[model samples]
Target: MAIIKLSAIERRRLSAFITCLVVAILAWVFTALSNPYKFTVKQIISFKNAPQKRAFHPLQSDTVNTIVQGSGWQMLFSRMNDDKKVIEVDLHTLENRNYVVLSSQLKQINFKKQINNEIIAVNPDTLFFDFSSRRVKKVPVKLITLLKYQKQFAQSAPVSIKPAFVTISGPAEILSKIDSWETDSVVLNGLNESYNARVKLRPSTEGNLEVLPKSVMVNIPVDEFTEKTLEIPVKLINNHNYYDVKIFPQKVKVTFTTSLTKYPDTNEDVFEAVADLDKWKLGGYSVLPVKLTHIPSYSKIVKVEPRNIDFIVKK
Candidate 1:
């Protein structure tokens, strides 16, 4: 090539352009030496639904050292503003997956920019939770009544807990209310003779509920006291027709106590007094019967103080 020479101004212009290129190259080298990009891995703790899009907060608050690889200019641009490349996460995904690992290369990151409080209150404060196996339980029934009989006596009727069953329904949490139920006890110790009384059926524990067949009729068994004195006629047994045997006492006095309700309208003829002469000859004798001489009419023998009496026979 032929030798070509340039003017002074051209030479100075060329020198200036070379100087600028060298400065640019040195600047590029310097940027490459300095770290401008960063890569980080963080743990996702929890997530919340937001009405509006917002950033996330990291679990750690301290700055973490991370390695980033990029062009000098690109790395420098990232360092200027570290927030643009942060990953966005959804609440549903977090809740479903339960855990997530976020790996990213950035200039710098902040934990505060990753989190925001723009959450919406889609769920109510009180939730109505339902259980699939919820079931109904039956409660028992109780009965209460009063009973009266003839004057001077009172008692409780054979009270029967009818249908003895109850039913209750509610949430599983509330079903425990049916553990126990009871009826009131009847008091009839003070009644005299016979009486007719009324009874009330009420819940042992007052509550906002009802019992089936709330009322019942009761028939109390009772007795009345009645005093009676009866004269029993004595009859001789096993006496031969030829031998005329006579009882010294023609009549025997007997007294008895019984319930008037049971003894009402009973006749005195129901009682009898008898004498045994199987071992005696035709003669006059006095003997007391060892057994009861009479049976009370329509009444049970509670006691007999003197069962026998002296008997004298004459032939």
Candidate 2:
């Protein structure tokens, strides 16, 4: 390789020429970007004011390419952005026809946009839909929850959902299979107190299905749970002959967990322990198993003492 050394004066002249060239390139780019240009971008299509007499299912994907006329800077920035752009299409015309001309609604869609770019056209120009018999039905809302409770805390009562039922309108064939709709999962962690809030329902997976009153109010009762034990008398059931039966243990200790608020009200009266005498006569079993026949549904049984009792029958 050969090296060519230049004088100080020559080096300065070369540097000045390179700086001028860079400046010229930047100026040209700025001028070009200021000019008007047209470009295409894909946006999601959402419908509003759907026809009440008929249901519609779109034949194409929800995405549509929009041809936009704007400045070169707008086109450059729009292409660089990754956010989902949604265009709302009015379906009022569907009451008379099965297709919608996108060009006719460009003014409305553009008015909702924040940018100054003009939507020139929508690819496919027209949106086609299949009509079906419209059906309206009321279905129960099932709450989906992902809950974590603090130590020694639990749900004290049933979860309450205001307006337990929601009105749904969609195609008859599709709505027939849907008996219930679920809300978006309500996630709460380390909860120690009662919770009340409004949650959004899960969006419809199908394009034609619609749910009214998109959200519902939810209430969850929370409390600290404590253990309680009671001695419950054991009663014999299926004593057809009214046999004189004496059990080794007359009573069994029932240990359960209940909310602190109901601790005082929970007692032996709320529980019933019974031994089936039919075990000896029908099953020929020597011992009878003690079973809690009646107990509060909310109570969680911990342990039952004397699970099996020895019995003597007087012939």
Find the candidate with the highest lDDT and give its number: 2
Looking at model 2, residue 26 earns an lDDT score of 95
Q: Which pairs clash (backbone N, Cα, C closer than 3 Å) in model 2?
A: none
Q: Across residues 77-104, which tens digit of lDDT does each residue of candidate 1 receive?
A: 5467645332233333332333233332
Q: Which candidate number would show the highest TM-score if scored against the true structure?
A: 2
lDDT of 2 at 236: 90
Per-residue C-alpha lDDT of model 2 across residues 192-214, encoded as one tens digit per residue: 99999999999997778889889
lDDT of 1: 0.46
Instruction: Please give the distance, in angstroms, between residue 126's alpha carbon in candidate 2 and its true position after superposition.
Output: 1.3
